[model samples]
Target: MIRLDTIKDIIVFLLAYIPPLLVFAKFWREKHKNIIVLIIITLIYLGGSIFTQNLLPFILIIFDIKFIKSAGTSYLDNKIDNTYNKTKFGRDINSVLKFDYNRFKFNGRNFSIFSALKLSAISYTVSLLISIVETILLSRLNVKLEGQEVVSWMSSMQLWRFIIIIPVMIIFAPVVEEFVFRWLFFEKIFKNRMGIYLSALISSLIFGFAHFNLRSFPILVWIGIFNCYLIDKKGYWYSVFNHFTFNFITTMALLIDKI
Candidate 1:
């Protein structure tokens, strides 16, 4: 017999999946879209993650080989170049990755680390407030919402688990996500003025929905927009830095909470 708790869990899972599925489906149906490429990249990412988690370490131990860095760099470079060529921008991947400090100037002033920090602080503070308000509203309405996946995962992990995941989460995730969402989607796919704005909205909504957290959806969307704005104003590196800072802060907060 199916237990009541199992049924509740299934219901919650479906609720979380439905909205993102709908958004993704809409994007898929749109012509001239890169949905297929996104799907392929996602599959490769999952497969590589599984292999790294299960087999790669054992292989390295057995062979005493320490070439993971070069292999990983080659893999990432190929993937980025493939995606770049597929996009409308048609720019070289190296050029896309270049950092231009002159581009950082905003309204006759140059961008600085302090400016980025201030923006991140404001974004995080406002998003946290919104999340708190959302949770309270949902509770008042008798709606049961699940906690964010990252927070829940972190809460249940030990120090060793954190040590294993920190580089992947803080370093790799921000770079890959910014490249896919902000650089590819907003900059390459939607290169025009109106299209760029529309892309930002659509991409932000999709990014938020992709997280599968209703309570934190608005917060994620705000972060997405902030990242997109950074890409638009400064460059891809700026957005990557902002994303890395945000993730690093959140990771530290989670660790502190666990402690």
Candidate 2:
């Protein structure tokens, strides 16, 4: 007989796929366009995974206009920027690259790198707290923490493999994920506050689900919320830094555990 906890796990697992399914359903009328986009993203991701062991960095470079015109500026950047400008949440994409924290002020003071780093630290701490809470909840529910395939794979990799992969995890992953999930998917697409919140929920849910770690889903979603807040307030790079710092710390922890 299936235990009650197993049934709960199954329900959660099925619910995790709901966002992507909704996305497909909403775009069913534009199925051809959606399919083409998905195919291109998948190919780029796979190529990076096969060759470099990192997908997001390659995707970011390929999508950057400075690197390649057709694949970068014409196809991805233009579409994302155009949509961004038309939305209420829109800001100049160029500003994101400029690192001008002065554009954002808090408590009558201009935002600085120090404050940004502080925010990143706070976000990381909050994510950890959320993870602890999630773990406790799962314990109470008698659900075994499942879905650690990525961690298992990482543990089995050689030193050289880690050296090659670490930079991608710290740098490329943050940049690419922020660009795709927060900038393009959330800010560029959503307009109102309600839309933004809904976008955050759905996008974060999808982000968590992508990791294939059901036990870490809530923690990932919390991180997603923190990232979305950064992008909405400051710009994409703020969230990128937050993401980078989080990944860097997590990667180090995993490395230490391996040792």
Please report the candidate that would top lDDT against the real structure. Answer: 2
| lDDT, each prediction | 0.59, 0.61
RMSD after CA superposition, every candidate: 11.0, 9.3
| lDDT per residue as tens, model 2, 41-88 | 556654544455345443443334231122223224445544532324
Give the backbone clash total of model 2: 0
Q: Candidate 1 local accuracy as lDDT?
A: 0.59
- Model 2 steric clash pairs: none
Candidate 1, residues 161-196: lDDT per residue as tens digits?
887878766776665566556755566556555576
Model 1 TM: 0.60
